[model samples]
Target: MLAPPSASPRSVPGLRVPGPRTEPAPGRGARAAYWARLLPLLAALACATRLPSFRWPLWSPDEGYLAVQARMLADGGELYETVVDRKPPLVPWLYAGAFTLFGDDSLLPLKLLALAAQLLTAVLLVSLARRRWGDGAGRTAGVLYLLISVGLNPEDAQAATFEVFMLPCTAAAMWCADRRRWGAAGAAVACAFLAKQTGGAVLLPVGWLLWRGGAARRDTGRLACGLGLPVLAAALLTTPTGFLFWTVTGSGAYASFTGSELHVLVRGLINAALLAAACAGILPPVVRVLRIARTGAAELWLWLASSVAAVLLGFHFFGHYYLQLMPPLALLGAAALQILPRERTVRALVASGCACAVFLAWGLLAPRPELAHATRLAQAVRADTGPRDRVLFWGMHPETYWLADRPPASRYLTAGLLTNYSGGRDGPQVGEKYAVEGAWPVFRREMRRDPPAVVVDDSRGKPFAPDRVPSLRRILSVGYAPVARVEGAVVYVRVGR
Candidate 1:
């Protein structure tokens, strides 16, 4: 035994001989560990880039309008009944929650919350990309999402709009569907719908996925239940009548004021194509996805199609409306990168990075005319009015109401009701006079019952037109006098109140 042990290692039941030491090969576990550490860092970086916009003044009137509604809700006001907006209740409620968690007065906290949602959406896109393709694709998808989302698209890129809020839920639904978790997918899609009514378009692809899977009937049933529950609960709480009338009927009226469908579609497609080309990284993936109709290819195509349909359906063609298309575009773009040679991919990524940098710089440095005007108006209003007093805007500027920290005199937040009544080229048809007249009585009643202390007439420096609504003009003449003029806005104070 001693002679044999001199040259050879002994093997025993419980012991083994050690050989030359070697490094362990990097496996899936190691890759997973690397991603686990990397994802958070990437997300933090993305969020950091948006810090400049935090204290930025209200640039979009829609955002300011939503903020006012949220503030009202936080102050124990009922949605739709007390504060009116045409959007679904969930967005206002979410804003209300943010205001409650932070203080209601400042917009910074709400902007921060929106930034958080943006980061989460980016992360979910990464995860979905990874599951569909691989780790490299996942990283690319997330980075692309961050770049495209924050680019200098103005209305969409800076504001806390419904499209910005709906992204995470949309991404989560796709991720869940990939995993065959039908119920979770349905629930996430429902959340998206709650965020924006157009988000219901996600159901088309999600339903297809459920139908193609095993246990189709049972899974479909689960999907339906998951999708229905929250909607049912929200409907019950809000009372379906008001919600339907506003979100559906009122929204139809709003859409009727949009550009012609042909013009809108052409403009939207051209703009979207230009945006995609500007980003550069997105086009290759879209091309690649189209060429290869793999197992999950149909789903991606469907998602893109549905998003386009949703955007065009509104007929508004606002830049933010195209935001619904970004997720699928990012995913397809990233996946396309995986098929390229290493050197070529590196070159492409570098080009994409440069483009993104340019866009980011533009977004951060660009001067916002609306924000500056809003700041001046807010300062003037704050100096003249008390917290208990109310202010009314006579034109389209709802941001003044928010910055001024004064409640609106009536439920008609925007001048849409008045503008619609006026019936210009882009306005409501001349035939809808009865409907427009019907809304005037309510506006008149509210304004007369609780008159505003300061009436800020923002009709481009013009005085209120006595001919359109003589009653309002009569009240303003009898009760108020010009106190301050800021920018093009003229502020009036109640006389001897």
Candidate 2:
């Protein structure tokens, strides 16, 4: 959460009698237009930081695979039926719909969507900052958010772009709710939920508004309707059979996924550190302190605390997850920036922010080349591997299932080498528990229950001793035989016809 703003004095409701108007300030309109023009250019310039091919291949193997899945879905097929993972349909639906409409799943549409959201978040930040603080603070906030990469990471390509698009809507709506503009608020909340499930969290602050007297009855109803309609749309979108792709399946786990401690630890450590630092930016206070703080602004402390809480829920600490609260948090940061007492402080913060931005850009783009190389694997598998093959990895998808632009059932593998997949031959590496407690047995049950044509794993990292019997190695050694081997990876085909 951005450090909470000190509260403002509550004003008694009143309607002032009409007063005489005064002449406009000398340079007001001109100055406003100049900023308006500069804002767009600055936003457009931000686009350069994210152009396709700029970073090449640093994408996680999973997201890249999603691109491939999106292509398959566009070609007319049930999703997850082929892709074999548990994730909401919104993203795939989004990717497939746009790809189908535009005729490509290139990074362009993703970038474009992210660009629009990024720009909107900036505009909303500018508006909110100006209203809450002053023009100086507003411009400063907008510029900082723009010039820095706190919310925007080119490395992730467009994974968290949903935050950009939906966040502004949520922020604007929350601001409107705070101002008693039910219509605007309703529209904003409704749009955010449609964009991402986590976005519905915006309702938390808006709900606080209702509790805190920030919203009127009419505004509340409008907000309900706005949020309700999108849900109705989703209900309409989901089919009876299309129910398995939830991020968390019916049980308390990641529906039926498993992965190694190494994979989990590597990703988790990096994400946790980043999120911890981001959270550090928001000074923590006890509930009583937040309630009593004279946060010279409206619900500043409350909102900041609430905003941070919003991000932490279901927070895997992924760098992109921070985008959920970043835009609004930017407003808080802007608010925080204004209260800076010294020029030296501002310079220090700004410089540090710039350095972080560079690191973020690298974090995002640096992996692009590796991700791009994984595409080669996809191509090789398609060309050499038989139709009855699945490309498995003891690790993350080199790019993403969707990125391969291939079919869902393409057997583009992601199961862990240590997992109990394929008669327990392939399972998460030896002692890994990251996804097992949540994902394993479900996947094992699925594989033992369903069974793909073959079991293939990269097995690139440290080898795991199969403590479980009926392992793939034993089964394959006795029955299935290795048909192909690439790098440190191996593809095992079930032995006899």
User: 167-231, model 2: which lDDT tens digit per residue?
Assistant: 66777776787677666676677677655556666777677777677466776777788767665
TM-score of each: 0.85, 0.72
The TM-score of predicted model 1 comes to 0.85
Of candidate 1, the 10-residue stretch with the lowest lDDT total is 9-18
Best by TM-score: 1
Task: Give the C-alpha miss distance for residue 250 in model 2, angstroms.
Answer: 2.7
Number of the top-ranking candidate, with lDDT as the measure: 1
Deviating ranges (above 4 Å) for candidate 1: 1-28, 257-274, 292-295, 421-438, 461-471, 474-478
Backbone clashes in model 1: 0
